[model samples]
Each structure stands twice: as C-alpha cells, then as structure tokens.
Target: MENEVLQDVMLTATILIPILAALVEVLKKAVKLPKNLLPLISVVLGLILGVVSYKFTDLDLVLRLWAGAFAGLAGTGLFEALKTRIGTTK
Candidate 1:
C-alpha cells in the first residue's frame, strides 16, 4: 500500500542520511573542520533526520530517538572504518 511505501522511503532515508554524511565528512578534508566537532555535527544531523522521518511517517517518539541514535553511531562508525581503510589515522 501507499503507507508501506512511504514507510520504506522514510526508513531508507533514515539509514542513508548518516552514511552519506559520513562519506562527505571523510572526503571533505579540505574544509578543515575541527576534529572534535564531527561527532556533534553527526548527532545533530541524525536528530534532524529523525525529526523529518517522524514528520513523514508518524513513527513513535522512541523509534525516532532510536533512529537518530543509530544514525549518529553509524556516521561515526562509517567515518572510522573509512579512515582505517584509507590509513589516515592521526
């Protein structure tokens, strides 16, 4: 049904946003962002994504929080994984 399709889209967005954010953060090293701020940025972006997902899907608050947390963690994990793979540790 239409509702199921919308839910799928929202879920996909919820997952991809953080991954994409991580990718951008990793690749945009020339931007010179402070290292300490990256996690905070990811968390805030994840929270915003969760709010948008909730607005679109009407999902419960707990689920939204989980989505946000997962997204934040995913961003950090992805960044670390990429960094390891690229051998760019500080």
Candidate 2:
C-alpha cells in the first residue's frame, strides 16, 4: 500500500509537470518576469494546483504537496531542456 501510494504521487507529479510547464510558458508570454524567477513561479503554481486538486485524488495533503514540488522542479527542467533543444534559449 505504501509503494502504491508513492507510485500514485509519482504519476501525479509526472502528469502535472507538462501542464505546469505549459502554464509557465503562458506566464512567460503574458507577464514580464525575469527568467530567473520562472522556476520559483512554477513551484508556487504547482503547489496551488496540487492543493486545489484535492477533489481529484485521494492522496493526503503532504503527499500531494510533495508531488507538486517534484512536478514544479521537473517542469522547469523539462521546459529548459526542450527550449535548449529547440534553439529557443534566452
């Protein structure tokens, strides 16, 4: 049961990463934030999304928060990697 729960958190994080990344992109375009602040924004956004999504999953608040943190970091990394690969950096 413990392992399954962890797996669920991992899955939730994985799913949220892309969505968070896209949201960051939208913010990037709509707002004039410094690039250095994007990751921080992503994390906060992820936490908000996770907490608000309680109705969608049975995970406890702590687990959901952990998943959100992971998703936020991963989302930043994924976005950076894709941006670099596509020659869109800076």
Candidate 3:
C-alpha cells in the first residue's frame, strides 16, 4: 500500500514537472519577472494543477499537494540542470 501510494505520487509528479517547466518558460519569456521568482511561480502553479487534478487521481488533497510541490521543485531543478549542461545560464 505504501509503495503504491509512493508510485502514484511519483508518477503524477513526473507528469507534472515537465508541464510546470514549460509553463515557467512561457512566463519567463512573456514577463520580465526576476529569475528567483520563477520557482515560486512554478510552485504556485503546481499547487493549482494539483488541486485541479483531484478528479484524475485517488489521492487526497494532502498527497496531491505533496506531488505538486515535488513537481514544482524538480521542474525548476530540471530546467537549471539542462541550462547548465547547455551552457545557457545568463
């Protein structure tokens, strides 16, 4: 049961991370906000997505929120990692 829950959250977060990253990228391009705020925005967006996705998963609000938070943070890290790898840091 524990493993199943973990798998569910991980799967959900994995799906959400890339989407959050893309959304952040779009916001970055459209807005002139500071780079530091991107992560926070991603988190907020994640939380919103998480809550909105309640119908898609059996997980409760708390678990969904956790998945969202993980997705948000991992999404930011993924973008940074790729950026560093590509030498595109500004």
Q: What is model 3's C-alpha RMSD?
A: 2.2
Candidate 3 residue 37 C-alpha distance from true site, Å: 1.1
Predicted candidate 3 versus true structure: per-residue lDDT over 1-90, tens digit per residue: 999999999998998999999999998999899988888999999988888888889998988999999999999999988774465445
lDDT of 2 by residue, 1-90 (tens): 999999999998998999999999999999999999999999999998788768878999988998898999999999888764465445
* Best candidate, TM-score: 2
Model-by-model lDDT, in order?
Answer: 0.65, 0.90, 0.90
Lowest summed lDDT across 10 adjacent residues in model 2 is found at: 81-90
lDDT of 2 at 1: 96
Sort every candidate by lDDT, greatest first.
3, 2, 1
lDDT of 3: 0.90
Per-residue CA lDDT of candidate 1, range 1-90, in tens?
A: 768755754575566565657554764565877777777777776766666676556666655655665677677767766555355445
Can you tell me which runs of candidate 1 are displaced by over 4 Å?
Answer: 1-14, 17-31, 55-58, 84-90
